[model samples]
Target: MPWCSTARLLHLRSGAAQLDRLEKGTTGLGTADALLALDCSAERHHVGTFQVPGDVNDLDFPLPGVRLESTNVIEGDGANGVACITRITTGPGVTDYVTHEQECTYSTFGIHVGQGDRLAFFGEGQNISVHLSDCRNDVGRPGAEITIGLAVSPYRVLTIPKGVAHTLDGLGGVVTRDEPVW
Candidate 1:
């Protein structure tokens, strides 16, 4: 029988959001069990997914091979600092560790992760959830080079629009990074 695994989507409102083809392989790290994903929308600025093609050699993470940090970390209402919040890290790209908020473009954006350095897969063909275009280099295609996955936060789908230059701000939903996630 084909081991069918479903991904609990980060974008779903209700019901079981399962990645039909995704199965658990191995978990590299799991502390608080946060959400993570890779953005695959060619247009970018919008959340999407892209599979790791057999022909593809490089990873499409953000520019300079970013190191994602916890920006909009919110402590649970009842839980204080003691409450373990969101903890994120790249499983497959350990060696490709880039600084937090590193600047990168498609041609300029790429990260390196050893065979085991990347994020953990629940099983072969397992799909993880990502925020989708968590950071956009520009409104145009310059940002399209960046391919993303739910680097963390596997359960909750969050869309944070932290505008450019780290100075522009918007309303609603509590944006903390100033980096728009499309």
Candidate 2:
């Protein structure tokens, strides 16, 4: 018989949110627990089960003053597929966090865990990965008002931070290094 799992979510005013897919099945046979949290150091409260293949960026989460931190895929069905986390600037240009297919397996990743306006999800399949997207609302604040687009692509969009360059390390993950220009 298929089993269900608990879920939790935490949203930070700084543009960060934590999501827990506690226990998910390969074919989405089990249930999930979703929670919304405020502030990176605050407690996580139960929200509800997420609709797989649903638009997560449209969710009306409370407390819009907190910054997001990371997307933690704690535990779930172990499968090999691709997941993308993209960071779109409010004006122009875009960044690709993780676009490699078959890379977002049961493993964990935090692509551009930072602040933005939207976050889209494009799982190789309709299965939800146990992960979190970190974010921070430190970009345009105080006196100056600016907004950025964090589109999680109903398909997948991962972004590398601006001004910082990355190189693929040994584990197929990007390694950050200081560079004078992109």
Candidate 3:
């Protein structure tokens, strides 16, 4: 559930809880009243967005991981919950395959950032198989920060970029299985 928006929305509708990411937006920063959508087809590397549906705008419910930039769309609220669109790096590891934990991996896909900021690289670069962490506060401040906690299955990946400051929980281990073909 870390960066999988489509999956979570389905869970929300089926279950009986809700979550949200942002209360409003900055420079088109947050949520809107459109269908839950995540698209990456333009020139931007990590650009992603969630659109509120056209029928359920007036629905009053909090959706976590959503940062409203312009104004909430006037319609569309088929469901209620928080949604995150993440772009995690997936590549060969040093020895075996590893899963990217959702707790520490902040997947920001197609979102632009300045060079001054550093990316939080998770997964293993060499063979050690590590839960990567870098001390770089890229999350601007106050209203600019977007943080959300989710329950998700494990995944394997390399660099992970968080929009703000985050702490990494490391799980050091050895990889005996060279590289996975899948």
Residues 81-105, model 3: lDDT tens digits: 3222242214332233345443433
Q: Compose the digit string of candidate 2's lDDT tens values, residues 1-182.
A: 11111111221221222233313222221223111111122222322333323344333212233222233333334474433323334544443334434443333222222223223343323333222322222322211111222322343322333211112212222211111112
lDDT for model 3 comes to 0.24
What's the ranking of the predictions by lDDT, best on top? 2, 1, 3
lDDT of each: 0.26, 0.27, 0.24
Which segments of model 1 are wrong by more than 4 Å? Answer: 1-44, 47-49, 54-57, 61-118, 133-182
Clashes of each: 49, 51, 49
> What is the TM-score of each predicted model, taking all chains together?
0.20, 0.28, 0.17
lDDT of 2 at 23: 30
Residue 68's lDDT in candidate 2: 26
What TM value does model 3 have? Answer: 0.17
lDDT of 1 by residue, 1-182 (tens): 11111112122222232222112323342211212222222333433344443333334344333333322235457544222224353332122222222221121111111121122111122333332222332343323222333322322222222211111111112212212121
Query: Candidate 2 vs. truth: CA RMSD?
Result: 17.8
